[model samples]
Target: MEQYDIAVIGAGPAGLFCAIHSIGPGIHVLLLEKNLQPGMKLRISGTGQCNITHDGDIRMFFPRYGAHGQFLRPALMSYTNQMLIRFFEERNLPMEITEGGKVFPVSHKAGDVCEVLIRECQHPGVDLRCGEPVHRVENTPLGFVLYTAGDTFSAKNLVIATGGASYPKTGSTGDGYRLAASLGHTITGIGPALTPLLIRNFPFADLAGMSFAGLPFSVWRENRKIFDGQGDILFTHTGLSGPGILDRSRDIRAGDEIQLSFAGPVQCDTFEREFQNIISRAPTRSIKTIIAGLGIPERLARQLPDLAGIPADSTGAHLTAAGRTILIGHLTACPLVVSSPGDLSVAMVTRGGVALGEVNVKTMESKLVPGLFFSGEVLDIDGDTGGFNLQAAFSTGFLAAQGISKRVGKRT
Candidate 1:
């Protein structure tokens, strides 16, 4: 059986980074990948542009990961976004920050990012093998042992960077959860994050391609408001999408109500007053015409009156008080009930994984099992879109490498 100083599973961003950083004199590292090639999902990130990391102060990145933000503070602060940019730029790959502060390679090719990591893996002391799926792992007093279909390997330290169950075609099929569970680690409730929502009886099927920037929206469960924020929203044939919807998808569940405000941040009462004033001033004008004047898209404005059960030819003067209230409700708080979120196949990230309580945030090492570590999406850490997830993967991987290196030094 072959032996290694450290063995890292899954050759996505996390595994590759851990292996690359773990290389040192006499410290042999084995990087195992189930797929035929490495970085399969990384190559498709950001629609192939590869938003590597967000350009901003590292302090602002905490809230992007939702409730798990503080847990990632040590890793993120250790490997800041500027340090990540410099790591690539030093290797001759320049980066650029486009609109919305998303950082990407100058060439705008995700393959470029993968190529750099692949080349780095070619260094001595790092053995990268593709198409080798680890079926099981066992802990030994001496170290850890990994089993494949035809091979077995031993390592003094192990890092499970197998990622979470998202984009399964790239080899992320929740295998890490199983492996972690076998090792006595708790796997939290797993579900799709950063996915689109399917609305029940969607009304805007005809306006599928329409999108809004910084659209204000709120989520409600029963009568209680659970979430209220704004982001770019896209109207799909089945429901809603875009950054605004995807970022908050983790917090939403089936049957939750999504209330969209087409008229910015105007409240119900404010909008009702403004609507009444508009109607009083333009009694001769059509309701749809008056709605379009309030900055709503003409097509959507035209359909709003019909959705509110108002006649097409009705003028503001013909709109009764009740009819006015209905129109205001539609404009201010158009409610759409979620039927379901996009499944794991469509989700960009997984919400849950090995519970964070079982792992050390400062070093990415397992608290229950010494010399065992985890990183990336497999460790109950998923961030919002626009490079936050990728950054977390790299930061955690780097921290895991540091932890493994220190333990190996102590053993030697």
Candidate 2:
């Protein structure tokens, strides 16, 4: 058997980073990838541009990872967004930040990001073997033994950096969950995150390409409001998409109610008062014209009156009190029922993985088993869109590498 000081499974961002940073004298690192190529998903991030990280203070990143943000503090603090940018910059890959604070390479190519990572793993101490998928793993007093189709390998330390179940074509097939479960780790309820919602009887089908910025919205389940936030919302042919819907998709489910405000962030009472003032000021103006003047898209404004059961040509002069109330309701809190959300096949990230309680947050090591660590989406940590997820992956990988290096040093 080929013995290694450390063996990392999956060559995604996490695995590749762990291997790269684990390089040291007398430290043999084995990086095994199932696919023929490495960084398949990384090559396609940000629709090929690869949003590498978010541009901000590291402290601002906590809430981006949802409920488990606090758990990633140590890892993120150890290797911050600034450090990540510097790592690539030192390698001659300059990064640029978007207007919305998303960081990407100056070349605007995700391939460049992958190229740098793959090149870094080419050190003499690292052995990157692609197309060598491990069938199973066994833990022994000596350490961990991996069984592959062609041969078996043993390592003093093992890191499972296999990604989540999103984008199966990129080789993220929830294999890590199975591997972790086999090792007596708890796996949480896994589902799709950062995916679009499919609305039931969607009304804005004709305005599929329309988008709203900073549109305030609320989620309600069985008449109880569960969440309230705002983001950019896009009208899709089937339902809704864009950062607003995708970021909150994890909290949404089938049959939940999504209340949207086309009139920005105004309260119901405030919006009604302002709208009534508009009617008093322009009693003869068409209702559609008044709505369009409120900064709503003309296309959507034209449909609102019809949806409110008022004539498309009705003006404030002829509008009834009941009609005004319905129109104001639609403008303020238009409720849309979610029939379903995009499935795992189209989801950008997986919401759950190995339970956080079983792992050491400071070291990314398995608390139940020594010499075993985890990183990336394989852990039950999923961040919002932009560069948060990738940053988390890289941060965890760096921490795991540090942990493994210290352990290996102690043994040596």
Candidate 3:
């Protein structure tokens, strides 16, 4: 058997970084990748711009990962975003932070970022084997043995960075989940996150290209409010998408009801008073024209009356008391029933993976299986869109490498 200090599966950002940091003059590292090329997903992140990480205070970054945010404290504190930025800058890879605080390569090419990682991982004593997939991993009494297509390899430590089940085309087909489960690790309920919602009987088919910035949205399940958020939302022929919906998709499930409020600056109560004043001032103006003054697009304003059971051509004075109440409700809460979540193949990230409780966030090692480590999307850590998930991947990978190095040194 080919013996090594550590064996890392998958060649995404996490695996590459782990191998680069774990291998040195006295250590031998093996990187096994199923795909023909490493960093396949990293090469296409952020639509090729590759949002590396968000440029912000480290204190504000952890909570974006939700409940598991606290779990990532040790790793994040060990390698802060500032350290990551400096690491890349020192390697001649300049980065720029957008107005929204997303950091991306100044070259505007995800391939460049992948190239740097690939080059660093190819250091002497690090064996990178592509087009090779490990079929099984066994924890023997002496160490761990990995069975691949052509041969078997053994290592004192193992790191699984197989990523999540999103974007299957990039080779992230949820293989790590099965591997961990086989080792008696608990796998959490997996679902799609950062994906669009498929609305049932969508009425805004004509408004497909229209988008609302800073749109206030809420989700209700069985008439109980579940989630509330605000972000940019885009209308699709089948449903809604954009930052607002994608960021909150994990909190939503099939058949949940969505409420979108287009009344940008007008409060429902204030609108009622202002609407009556408009009617008293201009009784002959069309109700459609009056509603258009509420700040929504004219086309959406024209359709508002239809939702309120009033004709589009009706004048302001034509609105009865009941019609006025209906209009106010419709304006405040436009409802859309969700049919389903976006397909996993299209989601930007996976919501769940190996149960967080089974892994030590400090070292990225398994609590049950000693010498077995995991990082990246294989764990039950998913963050909001805009460079958060990638940052977690790098930070966790760095911590896992540190853990593996210490363990291997002590064993030797």
The candidate maximizing TM-score is 1
Angstrom error of the Cα, residue 247, model 3: value is 0.5
In model 3, the runs with Cα more than 4 Å from the true position are: 265-267
Query: What lDDT is reached at residue 22 by model 3?
Result: 92
Residues 261-353, candidate 2, lDDT per residue (tens digit)? 998888888988899999999999999999999999998999999999998678899988889899999998999999999999999999999
lDDT of candidates 1 onward, in order: 0.93, 0.94, 0.89
For candidate 1, report its TM-score: 0.99
Candidates in order, TM-scores: namely 0.99, 0.98, 0.97
Per-candidate total of colliding backbone pairs: 0, 0, 0
C-alpha RMSD of candidate 3: 1.4
TM-score of 3: 0.97
Q: Model 2 residue 147 lDDT?
A: 94
Q: How close to the true structure is residue 156 of candidate 1, measured as C-alpha lDDT?
A: 90
TM-score of 2: 0.98
Q: Candidate 1 — worst ten consecutive residues by lDDT sum? A: 403-412
- For candidate 3, give the lDDT: 0.89
